[model samples]
Target: MSVTDRPVPSHDRIARAAFPRRRVLQAGLAAAAGAAVLQTTAPAEAAMRREGWIRSRIARMSVEQQVGQLFVMRVYGNDATASDNRNMNEYGVASPAEIVAKYHLGGVIYFAWADNLPTPAAGARLSNGLQRAALAAPGKVAVPLTISTDQETGIVARMPDPATVFPGAMALGAGRDPELTHDTYEITGAELRAVGVNNDYAPLGDVNVNPANPVIGVRSFSADPALVAELLVAGVNGLQSQQVSATAKHFPGHGDTDVDSHTGFPVIHHTREEWETIDAPPFRAAVEAGIDAIMTAHINVPALDPSGDPATLSKPIITDILRGELGFTGVVVTDSLGMAGVREKYGDAEVAIRAVEAGVDQLLNTPAADVQYNAVLDAVRSGRISRRRLDESLVRILGMKYDRGLHRDPFVDESAVDEIVGNATHKARAQEIADQTITLLRDDADLVPLPAGEVLVTGYGDTTTVNLAASLSDHGHPAQAFVTGSSPSQTLINSAVTRSAAAAVTVVLTYGADTNTAQQQLVQALRDAGRKVVVVAVRNPYDIAGLGDTPTYLATYSWLSVSTEALAKVLAGEIPAAGRLPVSIPSQADPDTELFGFGAGMDN
Candidate 1:
């Protein structure tokens, strides 16, 4: 059945069906006791008792406290050590303790530089310290802060060494197994939770149609909208099943644009029809699958709002398109307001005020927290921003915190941190997923599973060449390594060819060679030197177009160590290449012709 045609059961019915009879009876008994109290208690006490805990907490919050609940501040520090706190002045940002005490911040987001501690124990301590600070802050109602990070596995991971570095979104799509995708995210969720993180900004929903897209390259799952939607839903289920809130990001789609929103505004000129077919489906699927948050993109879509306001500040895009039309009632969050796409045009105060008015539930990662907090307070007090609207966002933000069980216990077990993060089972699963995602695009010469012989491996430095060479050696295939950086000179290419002259086969690894003429020249020189060349794209699969009709070609979609090991095993015939191309590969002969369509993989 189509997604739209699926039946959506009523909430009451679902609740009744999901709860056991004994649990239902317990609820009934509580309701009866509450009714008895209603009859005996004073009117105000009865009202407080009748209202839900979340609403009751909101009723008592001061205006400043209520406004503070909407902001998720960015903090900087390598760990929660006292020395790190003393060094906060270096970054010119307030310490976590001061920010929580002054602003009553709703959430905290960690970046690579801030949270990349040497061990999982340090990370857990940092998270615990942040939670303690938030709860102790002077406020009418002390709510636990939502701690989050970009733990999106591949290139965007914040915790690398201590966390299981799984293959990225494109690899998940190439594997074509939603169950594996779900399991991969489940393991990620567990690790994040182990360190006291309750939210993960992951599972990119953008359909990567443009190969040259700078930001959302391999971050996206597939170019096909339906495929992206399916994998996005699976990823959401995986995350939420582990009690971590998963975010579907850069919404209203940031896939087709060439400009990175980090530095400049990207404009998507698609009409409404095109958006419905290409961009809107994955978001719609996410909402239907019960995604906890939908992050607004900074890109401007002319069709959605002709005023040219980026979606982060455009009411038409966030309120009308996402909330009204798409029916995403979950928390609406803004991408980092500090990005040049939004920050360049508006001041911090104006950005915060306009984003709330635009229906954003959470204002994320603004450098100037004081300016934003005071601006929002002023707007609400002056009646420029409605109290009702403020309350609406507060409820959603607090609801997520409550659902995450933060109210009961906000701290993680620091002792268990080492036991959970990067465990043996999760690491093995990471390798399994990487093995499943290695695609063999071209093997016309049947050079793969090359008989045990001397092999020459040339690639981008130690991470790619050294690991691949060791894996080949593990499989009884002795291999030599040639480490060439992105821009390889002709002399290096000559050295590679001469070294491979006596070898049985030459394996060349590329990182986005499709756009680099120097790398293409190196590959062409290898082919011309009568070497049996097998080009493996370690990063971008589009590099296949650069090497014209190479006898054997493969794509690993990532340069992670596990991915490198998987590729080596595939080359040594220990495992078959099972992954298909998630995106199309343009032909070298005709730039307009696609040499390999989506889901194209060769096992033999």
Candidate 2:
């Protein structure tokens, strides 16, 4: 039967069915309690049953197996044990399946380059194979593996062609409807669940305060703490409602830094009060909403933790702030261990031990799974990491597996992959989201209903521009696309200008023109040539500050196909531009002044 043949049941019903109490326990409850007590107390009893089951499972696990449960490792393979895949052979195993069994792994993460997601069916097959290996591991270590991936929709999606390509967080923020955010994530969770991925590392909780932020630009929902918090709660509720665990990531915020943590260490000097007001609200909201997991950021905040350790390895940050102050009882997982943000301060073994010591429940994507496994094992044996500490994380990890229904059935029907992934309903919703996120900031020349003639679409990338042209042509607009590289050479600019002279209207897409003088030059040159130009900021809306005087200007927070296609329909007069800016566009001369304030949008 098709996975979407009927309406999806609520998460409460699904969880109850997946982790039902024993028949004896059910009978005992019926016999011991009056109907009124059972009616009011069933939820409490259910929680006790889940905790009891998790404890029983953990009690059976050996020390080696318990240590393994702390790490969520990654391997390179589509099949169980392909000889061609050798990225993880350091574990004395050739295939991912072999490694899962050899280490008695608690979970595995999928990455595109790891050859783990060629197709939806292949993903299901790989997940099933991994689950089988984990379940059949030796000596009381058999449990289902919690399969996961960074399917955060916009910029970080791993699944190809058939998966619904929804816009990124900034786009959704522009749409500015909490219920829309919820529905979009529900579709995202449904697709991931259909393919057997039980966990999603998504719904960023960062408040992007710095306009110069390098990494968390379009990934953030908005710059306002209250807005980000509102969307985050909706996203968490939406995703978990579909039975796939939702992870609110980069706790303590990665927003104000100009440096990319993946490459360098970033230090945020937000005072305790500033941190509490600007960055901590969304995470507090996620915890209040019962988020399944919270991923730690690798950035350092001196005001919060004077120890100078990154949040991923800082007891004060992870344990004191997140667990104690915020009262988060869910799993606390680290960002990838291989990123330079975490690695620059410590070695591999030290990183693993410190993360566990700092109260991180799961270590993600360690450089070498075997090294981390051995280090953690030795730490536990030597009491550097207490037995209580090891079991504490183990219980959270195991409990999440049971709650997400991974332990009940960790496999997906491969046959249903084609039916559910990128289906018509999901695609239409994606397009609708894209439509709502197209913010038309200005149209002074009133060239929106493009003057009737051939349209010239030129942009920084060939794929991006060509796709926009294709989408335009599909919208019955006669359009031709030209590629102007990020740093467009004078030659490419001259060619695009000459082509623009023959067209009635020219639509130019800018990517990071704010700092790229070459791109800024290209936009000015077109305006200097007296061509009818409409500028669209596709990557960063800050691009608008550079070309602010253009007669017609727009911002689509993402350059993904869904977003560009929505831009095409709007340009073709098929749909109206209805999105508001989620972040303010600061004036170039004075960063404190807004060239285009937040919530700026003009309809055609």
Candidate 3:
């Protein structure tokens, strides 16, 4: 039966029922699982084989079909027939394939919590199945989907086992080698392509000027806009060169806010003049480099738009500022619509309508796909969202798919996934990049090449500490690890102090120790006990500012396994520390005073 003639399903009817704004907008997401495999893809071919394929396709599309093209929904399950509670809760569908068919979806996003990335073969099967369903859906245009994910590498990497795990944007920024940045992302793009994902929401272009930023900290390349701009372009080139569409995200910048937009709205107080110099540079660079897509931040900037609407719903920010001022003609996509930053100001349906009116080309991860789809469909039929507007977004969205070669072939060989992702070459290159990001901030005690004696590795995540211990041991340094959980309690700290009594040297690996007194106490306690204390800020470098007289400290800019291994090598004198601080370290005692300025690092 044709898609239009098919009887409305019960779930669709339920989704269409009237409900309170909060109920419709409420969304839940589980944390992603850790570790996975990887894959590789060929260099991009010429843009869609047929010059006018998108135009021809759009001409034949019905309003309903055209509306579908503007959304990239989230679904649960690793394969077409797979179903789970998360799928039913989020999409009201039985399986991932059913969501694609029922919604006539433009594309679907993969998330680990949704069971969308259990294994490389599983991911390939899901991608291939979704593409088939998209073409087979009755009355729907046979356009392939732009399968996407947040494979930002480092802390945000989603591809599991065997996928090469490289350092994050900040780490690469610390290395300050654009060529290395390009090589890293090229490997990233190849792996994503091998898993059948066509788009990656990565290579953040935000300049993190605020050290107190609760979100975009290590995710950003650097606090220097020029540096961020330089690395962003190389990253974009690398990903697109591998045929995976690269997205420069959180436009107008999300790097200066103390609040995370995922849970709260953040306002950038930067005056227009300051924004021009600080926040606008990277985005300008992205446009010049021909980035494929730009993701909008759900942030409010009064200097640009006095309307109080966040960038996602403000025409002044999106249309006037981005499209007109910056001249970015590429696809403009909204951050997840379910985020509190976007939804707190409007209802679910209104959020979608306003985003489109704001000149956004796509709506990503809406609270409920059916509701937002119907809302946009109704608005289009009523002439509220102009036909010209709808056509503009359709052309851009479809063009992305075509240019990325999704239209030509969206299926990946499941069996071949194991051979491409996390292969020997990718792993070795990732390690090399990781080694380049280790920065030795201080070694006043001259204990860096570490004394020849037993060592105790403690602090932060249990897995991370254990891994560091193993990596150190692998480098011929005898070590034992002590777990101090994410937020180490006084008991845990006291226990660690007692445990370190027998060690010749105590290595405290901190996460966010600048804010956790227990972590600082653990470091101080070991020193008070007359044991040599070496503090390694595995996540953020600001930790040292809180520990007043730390004699030896290092910064890895991330806590990924590869980064930890690199730290082990540096600590064991197996490699020299070569990284510099990507962002400045602020003084905890006096926020006005500088703790350590940017570009502060010393070689071992």
Off by over 4 Å in 1: 1-51, 78-94, 588-591
Count the clashes in each prediction. 0, 0, 11
lDDT tens per residue, model 3, 1-604: 0011112123222222212234222233321111111111112223333447888889888888899888899887787887777778777778888888777778788898778888877888899999999888777779899899998888888898878999899999888777788989999998899889989998999999887788888888888887788788889988999899989999989989999999999999999999998899888878877788999999999999998899999999889999999999889999999899998888999999999999999899988777899999999999999999999898889888887888778888888898899999999999999999888888898888888888899988788889988988888888999998767788887898898888888888888888877788888878887878889887767888888989999989888888999999998998888888878887877778877777778878
Clashing residue pairs found in predicted model 2: none
Task: Pick out the ten consecutive residues of candidate 2 with the lowest summed lDDT.
Answer: 1-10
lDDT of 2 by residue, 213-302 (tens): 999988999987877887887888888988888899898899999999999989999999999998998888788778899999999999
**Scored by CA lDDT, what does every candidate get?**
0.82, 0.85, 0.85
For candidate 2, what is the lDDT? 0.85
* Ranked candidates (TM-score, high to low): 2, 3, 1
TM-score per candidate: 0.90, 0.93, 0.91
Cα displacement (angstroms), candidate 1, residue 194, comes to 0.4
Q: Which candidate is the best by TM-score?
A: 2
Candidate 3 accuracy as TM-score: 0.91
Better of 2 and 3 by TM-score: 2
Better of 1 and 3 by lDDT: 3
